[model samples]
Target chain A: MSEAVQLRRRLLLLTPLGVAAAGGVAFLAMLRGMQSGNFDPRGVPSPLVGRRIPDFSLPAQPPDGVGFGSADLLAAGRPVLVNFFASWCVPCVLEAPVLMQLKEAGVPIWGVAYKDQPDAAAQFLRANGDPYARLARDEPGRVAIDFGVYGVPESYFVDRSGIVRWRWAGGLSADTVSQELQPLLRKYA
Target chain B: MRTLLLLLLLAGPAWAVSSPSEMLPDRAQEQRAERIGEQLRCLVCQNQSIEDSEADLARDLRGIVRSRVVAGDSDRQVIAWMQARYGDFVRLDPPFRPLTWLLWSSPVLALAVGAGAVLAGRRRHAAPAPLSDAERARLADLL
Candidate 1:
């Protein structure tokens, strides 16, 4: 056979090999990215993804202080709202007025001051106007950990049985309160 | 009596408690570790934040993060250090740079090319080829 014919045959064999090599590289790149926890298109679901609340205890904030433990959370004979907040958290500030409204409307609300100073928490409540039935200071944030708090200003609607009914992350507005919060509250009621 | 004393001396090391430093992470170090963990990716796990992964490497990385923080590195510095050591593969959200530009853009480019090829194939099949005169004559003969 001529040199050109031989070259053509080699090219035909190499083309598929080149394509296969490129495809393998892409696959390995994706695998490596995922293994490195680097920008995965599909991330892991949290262990607290669909679980109930873990046990928690909180110290009472003074001036109408009540021990707001898990048992107190269930004592209301109604579902309770546990708002994880800190005075420094902006989203918590944003949701404060909405929580006040809920409190005024006879909704059971409690506050867990996550990883905050007791005095600072009290002052925050004084300034924002406390809407919580009980103010519980979580000094080391152990309660917040039990609640799976990734960030502050997260709210959990817990049923009378102490099971978490719904969780709202991020800032809460009137729309969220009306649309999502009320529906869950009604179900518990 | 001498044998009992020798046994007590040997067992003393076993009974000794690990220092708080050796056991639990210090507050400042723990906080730094957590921040670093959220930013880092687990190399052996899929899409898991280094803070959340149970893999052995992840634990080691967490310890490294804490040590770095204790050594007076800022959060940004710690992350930058990881990126330097791991080549941006340790970050869950990598910065958009020339090296990673293809990784980010390749999927959309592939999709666009695939769609174009499919549309072109459909258009070619949709159009009819004109019959030659000999084919028309054959059809006429058949009729």
Candidate 2:
């Protein structure tokens, strides 16, 4: 081959390989982040953080549970956890004990039964352990949508002024409660 | 190649998720809602648009979009409303912003890298040896 042609051919061959190497490095870094729990593929950051709770008022959960709204959260006088959960959500069941622990520690917890049938929700609470001080039913899910809830078992920590300080999208565990929620609650408190 | 084709087609079973009961009465508005919904990611379903996911959240999102349409929101306003609530993650088409500028600029970066690589490779092989006198004679004959 001609000298110039050989030079051009080498350039063509090496350029794609360099690009492939760059792509591979990026992919490996992502895998490391995922493995180290530094990145959660499923966790979506909430925009409502640091903003006031959206306008919403839900009716009481069925079978005599008390109802609450944005104003109620403002009047809480301390940080409160507003949890969107449902009877059908298995993660909510897993999250229940940690929620109860928080409630026992004098943290006021509000519940929104997201898209759950009234009777089913009431029964689920009774069976899974009700830790909520006041409960509401998001029957049509409008309130939950306004609060930017995507799935059941999501929780938002609202400051006394009703600002959403933190939001967790998945089921809360003891570790999450102790590590993330407690510190955030303390900060706003 | 099959995976690439699947990604091009959104890699999912595209089903009719928005039912007639949930549609707007005005056909044009409903169509607008549908178009908007197709551009929105369903929060409950990974990588599926609200228009393609059977999840309840997607249905709610569809209704929300229609409500905004009914209230006379422009397409940008409707999308902004969603972004206000759900962050830029709600959009199937990601917004170009500071946090996501890297993602948007990645293609440019890749092209730059490739160009750089080609230039470097070209330089490393620069000044190739002069053709043999015999080869030059052969080249002259061919020309």
Candidate 3:
């Protein structure tokens, strides 16, 4: 065969091979994405970020009689951290100490007792060491629904303007508090 | 057999009561809510649509859809509101956008490449050129 014909045949043979290589690359990229947590099953990205906190007014969990409301968030002149917790949730227990530490550091952390009975929620606070500056009862979880809370032990950091700056789902460990919450708090505060 | 029949009849009402009924003010609005709900994915369940999912979030989403439909929001407006609150992941069928271009186009690209390869192979292996008249005559003599 002439050199041109030979080259043409070779190029034709390479076409499918090139496509196969491309397929392999795409497959590898998908695997890498899964490994790097692009679609993390544990958490969904909060759409509340950069938006005003959802409106809610919930009765306070005693011994403090003051209720928690969206107005409180708006009236606050400083940044605030809002935590959603439930007495029935185990992760809430795990994150209680970290919340205490945050309070000790003078972070104005508000608490929402989501879907918990008053007695159970109060007992949980007493047992875990009360860290909330203001605690509210979200008995029907209407407020939690507005906040897009999937489960308990979620936290939101709001800036002075009442916009949610950050949110962390699941439990907060010491490492997460330091690496995630602390930095965001520093920026906003 | 009569006792068993009686028990089944007794249990049937409980089953009917447990199943979700139309919570919207009217049937037409309830249907609109269902159509919208079917398009929205249940964030908690991931795979099931809010209409099909019994998860708490799905129920809440269904309620939101019904309320929006009742409040005179268009279907598109309701969906946009949901997308704003839950991100694009809440939709069962994502809109065609730059980020989803690969997801929407990769299958077409693969099919095109596959068809091209098949056609090229067929052309390369086309039936041997029909025997020339001279060659046929020579083969006849040899036979």
Candidate 4:
């Protein structure tokens, strides 16, 4: 073949290989991206972040006999952690101690018992130790939908201005509390 | 008789499961909700759309879609609201955005590259210049 034809043939031969290599690199980058925890499938980012908490008036948990409303979030005059949990959620059971620790540290934690029967939620708190300064019932899960909750054991850190600063889904362990939750709490507080 | 009664009691709540259709107030709204639901991925089920999923979260999403439709939100607005709350992962057919451009286009790109390679190979091996007349004559004589 002529020199130009030979070069054309080589170029054509390498084109697919180059495309494949580029594709492989892209695939690897995606895998690495997922591994870095930016795209965690378990936790979807809430659109409510940096926005005011959705207006809600949920019935308070038993023993308190007082309901929590939107104004309560702002009246605190300090950042508060709102935790969404359910009696049926196993992870919520696991996260109970971490919430208790936050409460012990004087972090005002508001609990939203999502889609749980009042008696069952009360029993759960009785068994696991209530970490909530105030607890509310999210029956029909309307408040959860308003908050854009996907599953149980989710927590949101609302700033003093009633704007949600950070949200974490899934169970909270001691490590996550100290490393992730507390730092944001300190920042907002 | 006692065992049969116990079995009947165990199955008593089986009939209580209600179809999602019952939540909608009208047929048009239900159809609209279903169309939107089919486009939304059920976050709990991961692989199924909200319309096809039996999960509680899917049910809630379906209700939300129906309520939005009834409240006069257009289909596009409802979908946009969901996408905003749930991120791009909530849509089965993800939009062709900067982040998903590769995901949506890579297959077509691969096919084009394959076709190019095959066409180049065919050209490189093109039928031996159609065998010159003299060569054809010789081959016929040899045969």
Q: Which has the greatest lDDT?
A: 2
Greater-DockQ candidate between 1 and 2: 2
| Residue B35 local lDDT, model 3 | 86
Best by TM-score: 2
Candidate 4: tens digits of C-alpha lDDT, residues A87-143: 999999888888888888999989988999999999999999899999899979878
What is the C-alpha lDDT profile of model 4 across B24-130, one tens digit per residue?
A: 76878777878888899888888988888888988888878888899999999999988877778788998998988999899999999899989978986886557
Index of the highest-DockQ prediction? 2
The C-alpha RMSD in Å for every predicted model, in order, reads 16.7, 9.4, 5.3, 6.6
The C-alpha stretches of model 3 lying farther than 4 A from their native spots are A1-42, B1-18, B112-143
Error of 3 at B27 (Å): 2.6
Q: Candidate 1 chain B — worst ten consecutive residues by lDDT sum? A: B14-23
Residue-level lDDT of model 3, residues A1-189, one tens digit each, is 459779998988998899899999988987886664454654578889889998778997876688788889889889998999989999899999998998999999899998889899999999998999998888877788778787788899999889998888878888778877788887877
lDDT of candidate 3 vs native? 0.83
Model 4 chain B — which ten-residue stretch has the worst lDDT? B12-21
Off by over 4 Å in 4: A1-38, B1-25, B107-143
Tens digits of lDDT, candidate 2, B19-136: 5678678989988988998898898886998988889888778878989899999999999999988988888899888999999999999999899989987987888778999999
Q: Which ranges in model 1 have alpha carbons more than 4 Å from their true place? A: A1-50, B1-143
Point out the worst 10-residue segment of candidate 2 chain A by lDDT: A35-44
Candidate 3 structure quality by residue, lDDT tens digits, B1-143 = 99999998877343211145536658798787888888998878788888887776677778878888999999999999888777787788899999899999999999998999899889977876678898899999999
Ranking by TM-score: 2, 3, 4, 1
lDDT of 3 at B62: 81
The pairs that clash in candidate 2 are none
Q: Residue A85 of candidate 2: its Cα lDDT?
A: 93
The residue pairs in collision within model 4 are none
Can you write out model 1's per-residue Cα lDDT over B75-102, one digit (the tens) per residue?
8898876664344667888778997899
